[model samples]
Target: MSDRPSPGPDVVVVGAGAVGATIAYTALVRGSARRVALHDIDAAKLEAEVLDISHGLSFTPRGSIVGSDDVEVCRGARVVVVTAGAKQKPGQTRMDLAGSTVALVRTLMPRLLEVAPDATYVMVTNPVDVVTTAALRLTGLPSRQLFGSGTVLDSSRLRHAISRRVGVAVQNVHAYVVGEHGDTEFPLWSSASLGGVPVRDWSRGHGGRLDEAELAEIADEVVHAAYRIIAGKGATNYAVALACCQIVESVLRDERRVLPVSTLLEGEYGVSGVCLSVPTVVGADGAVERLAVPMSDDEQHRLRLSAASIRATLEAVGD
Candidate 1:
């Protein structure tokens, strides 16, 4: 056996389920962190995940995995990912899991803060906005340091929809699904473009045009994709897990990347005290700034409604 104690992991993922395990796997595959510690309440599940991931570690880029149930395993982690709690099931929205998940977050958060107060907490559990808001309030961590894997996946779905309809590479499509990462989420169509040109202009150039009604339909599809995916697969994990990995990477590398992540609002979008997805500049210090991009009146109104819904939940739970 190696005599030396294993070095502290750069990232510690709480919850060793599909989402947490996939985040660890992706981090290792992408070489984002030198070490990843996975923790869960279930020792058997945690061990199984670790062994499975370990079997593949040798063939991938270098990284180490440690599995344990002790919350103290989170010590010295630069990025702490929270993927715990009741996962969404088919025919269920994230809100459906709110009460139970809130209880779960309340139970686990104090322990996490006690052990890894300095670590950036990335909320991946369902009703993520609510859980993330509760975490910020309970831990008294700076609001910016707690975030959710929010509309990033929704935005990706939107981009894919536009790409398929327009017959262009999704990379060339730049759109965002902002606001709540749930049924009420809205896409920022006014600012969407490609190569600094309007999407409509690009469509016209390609001998086509996506009418407002068609665009709304596409947005509806984006909003419902999670439900559709969950209905088919029984859970929405892989895409979200990948999104969490990306956010963790940004924090660990100090990559000042903009993502439609759920962050605390302090007067941005004319709202405060609620966590919602907005374009944010994220770095090692967590959400650095909220991007106050101009939006059409309709889009702005929808954003307000979404923010209001989140605020109501936060208040209802009295977090």
Candidate 2:
């Protein structure tokens, strides 16, 4: 028999809960990774999830899925997506879970990093900005190699809202939600567009014109969409899992897709030392570059406010 060791998994999802399991399934089905490993503390849940997904392998692109309670399952992963944290209850803000989530990350991140030090880490636990900042401070990995799945989902929500209002395909609605992923997040309407037309200039055809007031309402809905989903269902998994898979695919495929992901800012837009979502280029190296997208002065101010909000949570968690 050959003595060569088998290569590690292409992706490692830490946490086998709703979000994590969905991410693992999405990655495999999308062909983002050929082998995905799931690591969680709960052995029964992990085992059940692995088996359930494994049963569906015949329908998906050729891939292998494995799970274990040990962090060793994460060893040699090229990309590690973290979704482990306290689940958010209805009426609770993402910041409300910060203390417990950040604490969990503090204890969990080092173990994952120890096994997959070279893996590009994507933090998805909410208050994601705070958790990401804590992870960066604790691990000291370069910012590009580690970032939060920030406003990527939020931006998708924003685009979807705009699409419905304008009666266009969501894929054609190009907009972004930047800043914190929580209550402080806001849309970059100044740069928003629908089918190459600036959003503000778009006139109604079948749908209503997106005027200033309607835009404001849309932004509010995007910010609270998660709460509405959480109130109805215990958690949001589908879209978020898809978003995480998009990041994983971009990294493994080196797609260099532009996404609004959270990374530590070093004087970008005059905000420094805080993790918040801004339009950034994500690829094999992780959040490789931050884009200086044009933003109205008001939008810039709001982004700073979002940064302050995340910084407060970081301090509260002793980061």
User: Largest lDDT belongs to which candidate?
Assistant: 2
Please write out the lDDT profile of model 1 over residues 153-239, one tens digit for every residue: 899889899888877788888999998899889888899986566776676667457888888899999999988987887777777
Q: Please give the RMSD to the true structure for each candidate, in Å.
A: 1.9, 0.9
Per-candidate local distance difference test: 0.84, 0.92
Candidate 2 local distance difference test against the native: 0.92
Question: What TM-score do all the candidates reach, one by one?
Answer: 0.95, 0.98
Off by over 4 Å in 2: 205-207
The lowest-lDDT stretch of 10 consecutive residues in candidate 1 is 199-208
TM-score of 1: 0.95
| Residue pair clashes in candidate 1 | none
Best by TM-score: 2
Clashing residue pairs, candidate 2? none
